[model samples]
Target: MLRTYFPLSFISTLILLISTCAYAEDHTDELHSATTQVTGFGTLGIAHSTTSQADIVRDLSQRSGVGASGRTSLALDSNFGLQLDQRINENTDAAIQLLARKADKDFVPELTWLYAAYTPNDRLKLRLGRVGFDAYMLADSRQVAYSYTWVRPPVDFFGSLIVSYFDGADAVLSFQDAQQGNYQVKLYAGFARGKSYTGHADYDFSLDGSRILGGHLAYQRGAWSARLGYSQLLVKNEYSSLVPVLDAFHTAPLATLIPDAAQLSAELGMQNKRIRYLSAGLVYDAGPLQVQAMFSQTSTNSLNFPDSYAAFLSASYRMGKWTPYATLSASRPVSAQIPLQPPANAPAELVQLYKDLNDGIHSQRNRQSTLSLGLRYDLSDASNLKLQIDRIHSREKFLVRKEAPDWNGQTMLLSASYNFVF
Candidate 1:
């Protein structure tokens, strides 16, 4: 089967090696045969960073990081997942995947995907329940580390997208053309319930009722493929960390600094704000050469949240069972200007509050870029080993914990991982 923009179709990409075996069971009145498939993937990785000031994390949902937390850590890049697929009749099937990964400083098992797929015809398919968030090209299968060549996805491009799955539904429409190749369009809607760490241990929050809606179009022709996607998410809850800040806007010295404290407080609140994301990606795999590139833009209605642009380009060449790859990724904010600042002679506490507020406005101004080189060696048909090194440069805080007093905005990261599929 050819890959499409749907999660089920993505199994044909790199995880197609999941072979099915038959099993027998006794029935009292009748005898029947059914195919129940079990498949799993995992990565055991150790990563090291040169920086000892700020810590590095894979995504925003994680509470701990590598670097300052520890120069080398296994919890940073290590994860495991298992999936079960059951076929019911010819047109309907169900699948559920359980994944164990670090979130909120603990390795917790959670259902990453649980859906029943109905294929009414050859060209259409529908799914309901918890489905993978397909906002980017690789997002549908991002948890399956063995499906990709990189030891891990680039942090600069994927780190901030904390939501992995949404509980709702999706539909996929596919068409095939002899001359143009396969075309697929997918649309999805759901509400997310993902937890996020706010860099402070005491300031975690959940996206309980955030509504998400998105769609994508994908085109594949032989060894080349392309995808364009757009998504809009409306945040429905406020951060607990902001309660004090909002309260402060109505209090003594802070209220004296501005006449429109209420308005500024509203702008700083994340509740009920809609964020828009747009992305485009291209991939080519021909013979021994493979290339992938993606660019994305994100904007939010909240004045405190800065707009951002992120992009990455990767290429690899295969030689027998070994593959060598290189990647370049970057992310930058549209503006770094502070939304509001206090006067020079303001009280020290009020001045600090304004500075914190300004930092929140330009929080996305990391101006981060990274270059990575890696090698992957096939250990067997079901497993592979990878070694990679990345040089990261940033003008501000990258995807990391709060900065230390002497922290620099550059670091060299070394990683080693063994990825397996069973």
Candidate 2:
């Protein structure tokens, strides 16, 4: 089924998908004899940016398809996803999820997760194939807006890090709480590939790596819950940012001054690199009030590409079917100076080249802070409408980043969406 949003039909767009699924499910229940089940989640969103310099995107891998200086766009915030779950037996099961989204204003649908699971015992479960990284409290539920209060999880914690799927295996161990809370520990190992978003378009090569490993420990007791996770990956950054730069220099006078400078400096762009991530979070949801906070860090083995950290806190009060919430989030790069500083008296061309390499290394240093307030209204058992506005401030022209120098360093975003699950 298709949910189209014409000027007037936008109101119906929010409920169309959910209503369609609900109707189908109600009819199927009468003849329900299949072991397999199908379910879905979707969102219809309209958003605008005050900066008009860049679009607010879901994550680093995604470009809003508008902005970087444009009035408004729809390719940035609309998405649809479907899942199929099949139970082969008491011990075996399989599940798959596919998400349709726009990357750089164009449709680039991909598989979110697909795996076969085996439960041999009550406490231990094994899964193999493509699966989500258990990075945070809501990593797996990123697409399901109804599962969380935010229109999207904070970009600092979720968007900065790119690795989301692993083509490997995992084991989860479950245990009873010592007193009140229950516990679960998950360990995974695999290989993965990540595509790079060069602001408005994709780069020539994606980040491919091997020997990816991670583990997560979580505890929950009634209204209180906490989790900590860590993961490391051995990556080969083969995107080759040096070739074109070096080729341009071949005919320049600078080539004679510095021999094979581009090739020597190319390592600054990073290849055969290692990546590590650490994250922790706590949540409380009891009665009418809810609170949540999380912190995450991303680092790499190379000196050129250093580290970044982000943290955010949020609270919301539930009043009947409406939940009004506020959140504060901040992200900053642990910026580092390049070790190879050019001579002060060097030629202007040479000096600019050095600056180019230095800036390239610390490009992620655009620090940002955000304050957002929103209200969510439940429309039905499986659908809700959300209205949110965010004030964004940045230290540099980094965020709302574009392939070109389009970041205006500050912006405001107003958004509305209808989210549903069925």
Candidate 3:
């Protein structure tokens, strides 16, 4: 039997919130003079997509997007976050972060990070609890809008991530070479539960307890930084929504047309599967020019899930308080097309099943590229305003919602945002 596992962070957050509230009633003085610091960051934004056939979304977690949801919507990139950092001792510290965004119908807040760090020596540090997914360069700080040049992370490269945090422990080791080149190595292991929003409903995915491990190597020199990373996960998921589809495959009439119906059913199930990811990133910054590039690939053991490749490059130049940038990004599935064709004389039920199966396949497949041009004006040290335009060429359905049958895939997007940190 299979069951959905709720994220542990939710329980932890409730416990912490209650304890702090009760304690504050008795020790308000201690709370005010405690060794703690509070900080926050957010983005106020709106966007428009030229086509009304489908709505463009930042990631799979969002239920609505920019086009069909509205001509202009704040749900795409607008968000807020608050963080508290407390120093427990000279060698220990703890932090918790709460984030609010349009993941559902309304702005709901959730605990994104809650971790305790211990540093016993200058060269090493350890952390335990729910930590950010550090699979790529921007994975940890992707929510801090003021830290990046783009209005949003490129959809082709960042939209496919399934989870952002994992309950785990990690160690970081720092080293310095003879020429004073700095290097760092990080290793982590954890269990996670996350969901992807299918047009119908949420599909819960589990990373099976302790079935994840990964590491990354990073190097830094004068005006350059480089990183290489690898990670693998074991998936144990049971999609309750797919029961009806599987039943039809096993039925008498449809089974007669597809003799290997049982095999096909097994291929559609997502259980005891493993996925591997590899990534590389480079950045250069000097004076008024900065350039960034990254590449990643994902391969999975499931037959219906396609292997994919994604990459992006961005360049920006700063002139006084105004900066201009350009970026190009693309992603596509490399796996062979699924062989799900049914006979022409098949029954009505079989034809309907074919359409259902095809849509499922297309949901995971991506073939798209985008060219973005944008400019940023600094409002202050803690805030900035940006305007961007993207010419999107989507050969296949990409990061979008409510795809219409008669819609073409070509479109343009105009976006603006105000980013601030405190």
Candidate 4:
């Protein structure tokens, strides 16, 4: 299926490009007289991973390391983007970018961004169509080899779920001065509805959702730049199969080691469910050294589970040809309490069992921390190499089984990429 879809998608893109180019050619004189220009950029990479346990790292941009062989593989982290600019007048112009890449389960190129912008002046600009959310300038561009020092951004900080991009419309405003330098403020609001695949069987489900609003602000002067951003996601759960099981465990009786028929009857209950997240961060750069930190917290009011919060800090230094960096990240659940409610049909024994389990499980929350270090060497203007090592630790008082081993392992990655702009 992928093989068949790949060619068709490519052909369609080719046709669109030809049509756009032909249209531009028709107005060649006008375009040439205006500030019309076209440019392209891309990156290619390969990496390896070694883990003590069986784990698969699958995400939107790359999907390798699926088997339990604990081996390495080559990855084409390549992307091609086109920038078209046509000046309408001295003070106003039109601009748009079309980006394509191999993502998730599909190898065929898809439209990553297709937005038209109107920059009437230096202070303000309006954009509509597919837009990129400036979650974090560095984080957003982590997949680009030339954008950062690490072979990959810190997973502890970046995480698997939080780093994904969204498609929407955005507006940007700028302020600048000869002495003070420049600052950019961006406001992004969009709706994204798609399915994300995780390794877990029960967790994979449709992501038909919408985001009401979000934005970021950035300032750059001399050798330093700083940014701050905040965004919220309102997610609806489409998976209903797991609800019964979740509710069963959450409301089962707690008095007996094992619940009897009567107790089980008293425990069954129904409740509402919803998931929400809040994300924010800041970054700074000075000369060859840079520092960044970010924080994110998520909560589900309907679920009895506690809120989750994560934090990350990183610093990097440059030395002639090699630049080295280090990062630390940690996450833990927040505190929240609510009275246990059970369905009318639930048995008393079942309700007691659930209460016991909930009390035991709620006593301790999930906590994870990771430390990473890496170095990048600039091979040339169009190429670079990077090597990174990460040590990760996860602990959960309630979730850890007596027989199951705790999660403490190291992952080493070596990647090199060649990028070109034409």
Candidate 5:
């Protein structure tokens, strides 16, 4: 499966490159005078974890002990991506991006964004086809540049319970006035139906989902920017006994040992299941100093999963080639009622163990916090380097008979990347 998928993804990338080159050649005369350009950027990173309790794998662009207890191993966070832009005419253009990474257990390149856009005038623009929505000004650009002064965006705050990339269409409208300063309002609605990899190990749920609607509004004057945005998603899962069984171990204890009969009854009880989220953010930038903060909450009633809330604050200062930054983030689980045991006919030991586990798990509501600090250096216009360290503390107790183990882990990471426009 790895061999087959790798080659297929490579072939598709090759086709895109060739097509882009061909298009450039056909418009060479226009290219000389046109502002259109093609650009590419990538990162190469390596890090090691010092603690034995957690494995240091590159989950995203940072080295963290997250999900390390199962397969504690060293890993790399290497990724490459490309962007293409064509200026069809003044005030109108098209652009697309592709990214390859070790997001899955194997290497695969995914279509990050592909869209045609018309700027029309400076205050408004329209886009069609797989557009990238900048929920925050820096949100869309987060992963592309490793120069951001953090091992990774605080996971507690940025983690999405559902899918990341969205498909379909969107638009942006801006309003500018001399006395009122400048305000940008963006409205977008889309639907996406595809398979996405959720970070959890137990569930490899194939997604047949759609994004109902979302939008962002921002006001900026001088060095300060404030944004308010809301987005909602409707996701459906195709049942798989194997995937659920694997995921159950990680879910709350009560949901883990459900009997076959109880599972059937619960399925019947849940005729409708939906996951939804809403988020907002704010940022301020002054000479040599920058600050940002965000808050998000999510709810899913049918999965017996608790409603979740996350928030983070980050600040950075630049001095010459070096920029130092600090970040703090936290998340908590909501409350929910889930199944705890099977039928009376089940094994005596199994039933007893299940009860003990469930009781322990119920005590562990959502509770986790992370602190990070880092430095960033801009080597040049096309290259940069970054180093970041993270300390994570998970307070939720496990449902096992014994007390859940405490997670106090530290992670260090070094990363470098280059960007070029062709």
Candidate 6:
């Protein structure tokens, strides 16, 4: 078996930190007022995609998530997650999180997080293991639906990348100023390996020893907070299955439209693809109203997957136990094109096929310019009920060349979820 894994450095560092933190915490507890506590949080959500030809998933990483297409036989938007935290002492803690989610008709349980965190001083804290590098405002709290207004985070923004964690270390800095607001920043590096959906099927890829470096900066004052973040993860992707797609381009009528198919393959799939992401957002939470807006972009050198951008504005008004919210989101691919100049004698159908291939480039995107309105009622402090409806458009296509493409459509979706924390 060709079993690939992260270098043991990430794992070994984790063991050392866990042992150090636990011992330090336990030793301090005997003489001081330090204590340990356990905590948990999660959500139960369901969504209905109204278009029979389209499946509306919460994020691109979800394999079997919800949609109206034939997938109606399944409810894809639902998921459950649990987290455990053990405080070794006032300055140290160990944590683990487990999530069970549906992917392509199967429910799989996986460990989402495992780490030990230590605060050496009031301003500095360090963490080691599998930890999320914040790409957005609520990036770390995304799985907790009750913390947000919508049925789900705007997919247009959050769905831009599937890989959230890297096996490594992070240093967090927080500064407090009497004259100014609070400032916080996080810096991290590690290797990220995972199976991500490429061309509709899951493809496995590793960091190839390239380090992942990223961080976020934030300022908070009273009821307002603003944040900006950027990250770069260079992936030398190996697309073994895509070899056939690149091979077929060399023969027959298709060759005319794509003369340098091999070059295109190298540009899109072969190696040295640096995936860079940028995001900025602001939030205002005061009185009975909560308002926020976010803008995000993913840049890379992949012809098949061009650079993408998204942004959204959301507002919610809280009325006792009832909260109503509205959101406007947009997503699109930039410089998404397939060069083509068919000979005049070429059959009309062949030319159309060429055009379809160009269209298919952006069709890989699942969300665009959506509007959502929803209401929420607190079932209790630990749980709440949400009912939401999204007006969405679909331009999805099959990734494999063999299957015929799906026509575009639009629909209104209904969603309901119950979120909890204990």
**What is the per-residue lDDT of model 5 for residues 195-261, given as tens digits with 9 covering 90 to 100?**
4322223323444445547787788888877777776655455435334433444455534454353
Indicate whether candidate 3 or candidate 4 has the larger TM-score: 3
Question: Cα deviation of 302 in candidate 5 (Å)?
Answer: 2.8
Tens digit of per-residue lDDT, candidate 6, span 289-345: 999999888777765556778899999999999999999988776644444444567
Q: Rate the local accuracy (lDDT) of all candidates.
A: 0.79, 0.71, 0.78, 0.54, 0.57, 0.67
Which digits, one per residue and each the tens of the lDDT, describe model 3 over residues 85-201? 898998999999987666653445777889999999888999999888878899888878789999998888887766677888899999899988999999998886455563332
The order by descending TM-score is: 1, 3, 2, 6, 5, 4
Model 5: clashing residue pairs?
333-366
Model 4 lDDT tens row, 1-422? 01122346655775676576667767877768767876455555454445434332434233333213334433334455556876666655555666565444444544545566677777888877665544645655655556667655655444434324455667789998778878888887676545543222223445445453677777788766666676655544433443555444434343233444333322321122334445665667777887877777755553333467778888988888788989888767775443345545678775675576465335334355767787778877756777666565645322111112333433444445555544
- Which parts of model 2 have CA positions greater than 4 angstroms off? 1-27, 30-32, 198-205, 208-211, 245-267, 336-340, 403-408
In order of appearance, the predictions have TM-scores of 0.89, 0.86, 0.86, 0.69, 0.74, 0.80
Q: Where is model 1 more than 4 Å wrong at Cα?
A: 1-32, 178-180, 198-203, 250-257, 343-349
Clashing pairs in 3: none
Clashes of 3: 0
Ten-residue region with minimum lDDT total, candidate 1 = 20-29
Query: Which parts of model 4 are misplaced by more than 4 Å?
Result: 1-38, 56-70, 76-103, 160-167, 176-181, 197-202, 240-282, 300-306, 335-367, 396-422
Model 4 CA lDDT for position 369: 73
lDDT of 6 at 262: 53
User: Candidate 1, overall lDDT?
Assistant: 0.79
C-alpha displacement of 383 in model 1, angstroms? 1.0
Best by TM-score: 1
By how many angstroms RMSD does model 6 differ from the true structure? 7.8
Better of 3 and 6 by lDDT: 3
